[model samples]
Target: MSENNKIAKELVEAVGGKENIASVAHCATRLRIMVVDKDKIDQPKVESVDKVKGAFYNSGQYQVIFGTGTVNRIYEEVTKLGLESSTKDELKKEAGKSGNWFQRAIRTFGDVFVPIIPALVATGLFMGVRGLVMQEQILGLFGLSPADISDNFLLFTEILTDTAFIFLPALVAWSTFRVFGGNPIIGLVLGLMLVSPALPNAWAVAGGDVTPIMFMGFIPVVGYQGSVLPAFIAGIVGAKLEKWIRKRVPEALDLILTPFLTLLIMSTLALFVIGPIFHSLEEVILNVTVSVLSWPLGLSGLLIGALNQVIVVTGVHHVFNLLEIQLLERFGNNPYNAIITCSVAAQGGAALAVGLKTKSKKLKALALPSSFSAFLGITEPAIFGVNLRYMKPFIMGLIGGGAGGFLASIFGLKASGMAITVIPGTLLFLNGQILLYILVNLVAIAVAFVLTWMFGYSDKQLEQTNEA
Candidate 1:
């Protein structure tokens, strides 16, 4: 058999043969399998299989990390073995049946927020570039002052940088509705209403430049530009309300009355009830997050950085999306991104150390490429493939992350965006913080590399793992 075919066969046996697999699917970097019985699988053998970078049980699925292109080939081979084929979305539903209530909630948040990350990343990059070009030093190099810059050009930059945040509610609501099984277009319209031109701007109200409109002479109302929680909650309510109304409305009127009643009731409740209550709660959450990140001597950063990867292992790190959104909305920068970047970079460093120190060619090949992947901001390969496989390396990485995060806190390092981190994270720091960002990541890598090289790896352990 070919090498891929061999690996695929071995993987099937390792996971208790094809009979134990309920369904199989592949994403960009991992072969995700829903297994019939977890207790029947041979976990160690699965990890030791040739060309298999790593394997782990998560979200009720046995996810085998085979790196990017390799997974597709292996997945094809696995399917050739008479396994049932499935899509990633279907696999997600299968896995979704296993997590606890909290995990499900966190996953829901992830489902909603993850789709919106690309727009935010693009907007952040635009903001960074605009800020870079508008710098006094940069302008001086062009023999021009701020006054010499064209108003139309500045207006263009504003459109690129501000549009995403100004319509952030719409994005959140649309995603939430999609996740909750409601019509996304209806959600989009509801979100737009929250930020309608007739409403007082939220930022303007905060700045005391505009007064909020009063509903019933008591409830102050303003636009939800840059708001997340209100939009998310409103989306959930509106979707459920629409479903409820749809079930009751007569078939003849279902097309018209359902949407009309849903919109009318939801709009009133969102403005008068959900918006006011949830926005206050969002502010409270934002305040608490700020307080934690602002703790004395960077203790909060140290703890967060040290534990960030640990959280990732549990598959609940998506919960951070709320904190990140809050930070960006409140301060226009994200320190959490800087701190977590250190944690991610540290994983790369530990994996790199193992790759350099290992006598096993299989491990060296896996570790080296996975480590590089970590540097580019995707850490699953490095974490599962190398660092966690060797416990000492994982702990050393945590320490390195903590050390780098301490420095990040002391320096007050913040990124202009979220979603992207590590090397690609440089874009978020382009607004005059590039040097500090590099310094923090380098420190994380160096600390993890030195510690793991000195003590984390051993040929003896590799021999044992292979023997298993």
Candidate 2:
């Protein structure tokens, strides 16, 4: 048998065969298996499977790590074992049932925001480049004055930096629709309509550059340019409404009427009702978050940094995308990303320490790549596969992250983008503060490494004991 098939067979047996698996799915790096009987799992055996870095049960799924490309192969192999397989969405639905109300809500928030991150990340990198080129020192290197730079080139940069936020509502709505089992295209259309050119631009209205047209005499209605909550809430309402409409409409007419009524109804509700109310709520939320983030002595920074990994483990870290967006919209830049980058670096540092300290060949192989992955701002491999497995390393990482975050806040480190961190995140600070960004990351890595080496991990003594 092939290596994939070999491992797949072992994994299935370790999880109590195909009968115990209610549903199986893979996400990025882990095979998320929902099992009928948790006790039936042979956890150690699962961990020992070839190419399997680690295994854990979280929320409601038995997650087996196979790292990036390997997980997909193992997933395909597992499906061939006559077990029921599920899409990411279907797995999310099943897993959602196991968590408490708060946990479920956080997961839902992650579901909505995670899909929109790539757009934000791309925009952020463009913003970083834009910031760099606009710098006097950077322009001096090219012997070009700010006025000497072509207006057309500057205009293109503006488009790159501005387009994502300008159409953020549509992105949010589309993802929300997918999460809620609605027609994504229809959801996208409704979202686009919420920010139609016919309405006053939201940013212009906010800046008092354009007056919002009065609706029903008193309600000031404008396009939801950078608004998130309204589009997300509208998506849920539109999706549920569309699903309800789909059931009642005749099949022949369903194709035509369902989309029409759904769009028409959702557009009306979003603009006349949901948009105005949620915009106000968004403002309030932004204010609260800003207040907390601005807390004295870097209190908020330390708290968020220390617990960020824990949040990521629960799969709700994507909500930070919303917070980052809000911060950038209100303050023209986000310091939170700077803080988050430090936390991310600490995980890599801790994993590196563990990798160097471990005596087991399997553990060393797993730790090295996972650490590198963490440094590149995808920390799952390090977190689930290594650090979290050794509880002390995780805590040491948090302590290091908190210290780094506090320093970042103290120095007022900020970024031009929401996504991308650690190594790639250097671009966001390249305009003038790259050194500070580098320093914070170095501090995080150093602290986590030293602390983890001291107290976070051991050199296979426990493994030898278990074997004996």
TM-score, model 1 to reference: 0.97
Predict model 2's lDDT versus the native: 0.88
Q: Write the per-residue lDDT of candidate 1 for residues 143-204, one digit (tens) a residue.
A: 98888999999999889988888999999989988888889999999999999999999999
Candidate no. 2 TM-score: 0.93
Q: Candidate 2 at 417: error in angstroms?
A: 1.4
Each prediction's number of clashing residue pairs: 0, 0
How far residue 300's Cα lies from its native spot in candidate 2, in Å, is 2.3
Candidate 1 clashes between residue pairs 3 or more apart in a chain or in different chains: none
How close is every model to the real structure, measured as TM-score? 0.97, 0.93
Q: What value of lDDT does candidate 1 attain over all alpha carbons? A: 0.90
Please state every model's RMSD to the true fold in angstroms.
Answer: 1.4, 2.2
